[model samples]
Every structure is written in structure tokens, then in C-alpha cells.
Target: MEKNHEFIRYVLPKGKTFSGLTQAQATLIANHINSTARASLNGCTPFELALLLLDRKLLELCHMAWIPADQVTLKPTLLK
Candidate 1:
């Protein structure tokens, strides 16, 4: 929730509206965010945590995939 919204706000340009975002753009943002390492997770990314704790079928249903560390992009330009 709040954290997810905050991440989205941080990744999008100022004054940009969510309605203008395409599905592909949204998925890219989500993938990048999940792929990023977090201190709260003890350096593990959300994607890694999910892989360890969640069912593979559920993840597949959600279209989630592991983004390589070197390939993860957190910048607003990710949507561009």
C-alpha cells in the first residue's frame, strides 16, 4: 500500500498521471521496484523474497519474474 504508492510516486515524473501510463510501463515499474534490494529485507529484493516464500504458480499467474541485479532500473526514465 502506502509503500507501493510511494514507490510509484517516486518513479513517475512530477505532475504525471497514472491514467496516462500504459500496462507495459506499469509492469516495468513494478518489476524494477520488486527487483531492488531493500534494507528491511536484509539486502534481499522483494522478488527474491517472493521466490522463497510464495508458490511458483501464483507468481506465474501474476506474471512476476526475477530481474537481474545489473538490469534493474529504478529511475523515472524506466517508464520512458
Candidate 2:
């Protein structure tokens, strides 16, 4: 959580204040940061990293449960 707060502060434009910021503006800033390439991701965006991790997690769960492909339908809403 501390890292996230630091990231929010770093991404906010110079001379801008977070005070009274609207939800839309806050989301725009967050999306911008998440999409920007980072050295830690070897030039991949965080969203890409998240999707890769999510896929691995889903596969792991399916294996653990011995779930048959025909018995399960992993819908897009499951990601949310």
C-alpha cells in the first residue's frame, strides 16, 4: 500500500494536487501509470504482467481441481 501511494504521488503532474480530484481523473492517472513500461517488467506494462499472472493462476487452479475442459467455462467476468 505504501508503494501504491508513492506511485500515485510520483505520477501526479507537477503543481497538481490530489485534493478534490474526481474519480474519472484518478482512474485516468492510475491507468496511465499501469500502462507505462517499467524496467522491472523488462519493458512490459503492469497490465500485461497482471494478465500473464492471472492466466497462470487460472491454469493452476484448474489442475488442482482436476477440472475437465468441457465442465468449465471461464468467462471474461471471472477476471473481474
Candidate 3:
């Protein structure tokens, strides 16, 4: 809380790297949220949440970009 969390609240980052704050402040928030959320879970950190979020988003994007296939091809090997 020495740098950023000294204040009661903060705005989420608008871009990469949790911008517009001090490292100590960012660390404090990360630690608190990790501890609390982890305790509630069996010991999982927010990083796990982030990974799950990324996977879900990727799956959604893939589904959006999916295309119908005209036919299937079975290839044992490619010939030179």
C-alpha cells in the first residue's frame, strides 16, 4: 500500500502491463486479491483465473471464425 493502494480505489488498466501506477501499489492489490480469492478456492491464484479467461476467449474467437468443410481428406503422407 506504500505506492498505489495508499488510495482507497484505483482504475483498471486500459492497456497492456497494468499501466498508470507504481509497482508497489500493483503488488499490494495483486497480493490481497490473490490471498483472499485463493483462500476461497482451495489455493488457486488469480493467474489461474486469467488463464481460464484467455482460453475461453480464444475458444469463442475460434468458434466465430469456423468454416464449413466441403469434403474431408485422409492423407497417410505427402509425396515428393
Candidate 4:
């Protein structure tokens, strides 16, 4: 909810109505924002942050004693 409000206040033109946006337009706008860097993320975009988190999780799993050592070579397919 707060993210939506921030988008409206900063991204949308003055006096523009949210209802005026088409579904595709709204999604495009949202994707653009998520891909853009923000100060709150210390200059990383939300997408980058998510990928970083995923990488950390993968590392942690690979370090687990029960996990096969060969599995450490596996990488996240989507992010690449």
C-alpha cells in the first residue's frame, strides 16, 4: 500500500487519476520502478536485492553438512 502511494505521489503526473491507467500501463510502471535504484536499498534496485538474498540462501544451503558437496556448484537459473 505504501509502495503504491509512493508511486502515485512521485511517478504519476500531477492530478492524474489512478483509474485512468490501463492494466498493461500499470504493470509497466511498476516493473520500471522495481528495476530502478533507490537510496533506501543503498543504491541497489529491488530486483538486485532479491537476487543477492537468493545467492546468500544458496550459499548457506551449500554449507550445510548433509548437503552434497557437488551441489555447491549449482546456481540460480533465472537470475543468470
Candidate 5:
């Protein structure tokens, strides 16, 4: 979260995708999420969220992981 704070354009409430990002920067965000307090997420980890999405192709776990970050913001639903 703090990683993107420098780029308020990404969290503009209206969102701003397609922005420039490096693999290292992405890893920073992932690590930040991994190190944060996730007990409020029903005992699930952020990596698990990504794994589940790839395994089940569903966003049903968004409530447990948190929206817009846990899952892709694309409109083309990966799961019905």
C-alpha cells in the first residue's frame, strides 16, 4: 500500500491501471502485503489468494483477502 502512495494516481479512487511498474516494485508490494497483519483475513495469506485464483479462477475469496488488490480489476470475469 505504502509503495503506491508515492503514485497517488494508482489509488485515485477512480483507479489508474497500465501505469509503469517493475518486477522489483511489484515484489515490494507483494512483500508488504505478506508482512502485514492478515489475521483479519480469516487466517489466509496473500500468496494463497493468488494461488487460489490461479487454481479456481474465482474471486470468491476477495472478502477474505481484500478487493481490488487480492484480485485483478479486469472487467472480463475469469469466473462466472
Candidate 6:
């Protein structure tokens, strides 16, 4: 999907290859992304919405966590 591509581009370092990205780095990025509030979600973050709607066990199985809104980081420094 185009959004997925955009997210990948947003998270990846400029001029860097995604192939070099590690799983831990990806997880960190993912957590930050999910923690971000979106207009599409009426300003509620994906993590908050998931916690309200999805089963807690399922969330735990996926290793998802609620990153505090103030702590969310979507910049290149996040992966540094």
C-alpha cells in the first residue's frame, strides 16, 4: 500500500537501504508509529484504539505496548 511505503520512507534514513534495517530497529519504529495520534482516528493513537478494541492477550502476543504520547518519537534520531 502507498501508506505503508510512505511510512517506510518516513522511518528509514535518507539514502539508506531498508535491507540494512534490523528487527529491533523496526520494532522501535513501529511502536513510535503506532503511538502517534492520527486525524483519521479522530486524534486517538493506534495503540490507544487497539487497547480499547483489541484483546489484551492478542496485543501482548504481538509484543505491542503503549508508548506514552509525550514519549513518541518519529524522527531519524529515534533509530540512532
Specify the highest-TM-score model's number. Answer: 1
Deviation in Å, model 3, residue 68 alpha carbon: 53
Candidate 1 lDDT, 1-80, residue by residue in tens: 46667788788856978898887788778887898888888999999999999998998887787889998876677776
How close to the true structure is residue 33 of candidate 2, measured as C-alpha lDDT? 50
If both were scored by TM-score, which would come out higher, candidate 2 or candidate 5? 2
- After superposition on all C-alphas, the RMSD of every candidate to the true structure, in Å, is 1.7, 13.0, 18.8, 13.9, 12.2, 2.0
Q: What is the C-alpha lDDT profile of model 3 across 17-75, one tens digit per residue?
A: 54555755444444343333344446654445555566757634433221122221111
True-structure lDDT of candidate 2: 0.51
Give the TM-score comparing model 4 with the true structure, all chains together.
Answer: 0.48
Q: Give me the displacement of residue 30 in model 6, in angstroms.
A: 0.8
Assess every candidate by TM-score.
Answer: 0.82, 0.49, 0.27, 0.48, 0.32, 0.79
Lowest summed lDDT window (length 10), candidate 6: 1-10
TM-score of 3: 0.27
Clashing pairs in 6: none
lDDT of each: 0.82, 0.51, 0.37, 0.50, 0.42, 0.79
Q: How many residue pairs clash (N, CA or C atoms closer than 3 angstroms) in each of the candidate models, in the order given?
A: 0, 0, 0, 0, 0, 0
Please write out the lDDT profile of model 2 over residues 1-80, one tens digit for every residue: 45456666665545657686766555545554555556777977665676667675763443322223243222222212
How far does residue 10 in candidate 6 sit from its true spot (Å)? 2.9
lDDT of 5 by residue, 4-62 (tens): 45433332324545356555444444444443335655766565656556653343333
The CA root-mean-square deviation of candidate 2, after full C-alpha superposition on the true structure, stands at 13.0
Off by over 4 Å in 4: 1-4, 52-80
lDDT of 6 by residue, 1-80 (tens): 35545666676756978787787787777788888788888998888999999999998877788789899776677888
Which clashing pairs does model 4 show?
none
Give the clash count for model 1.
0
lDDT of 4 by residue, 15-60 (tens): 7576766665555454445565667889766656656666656634
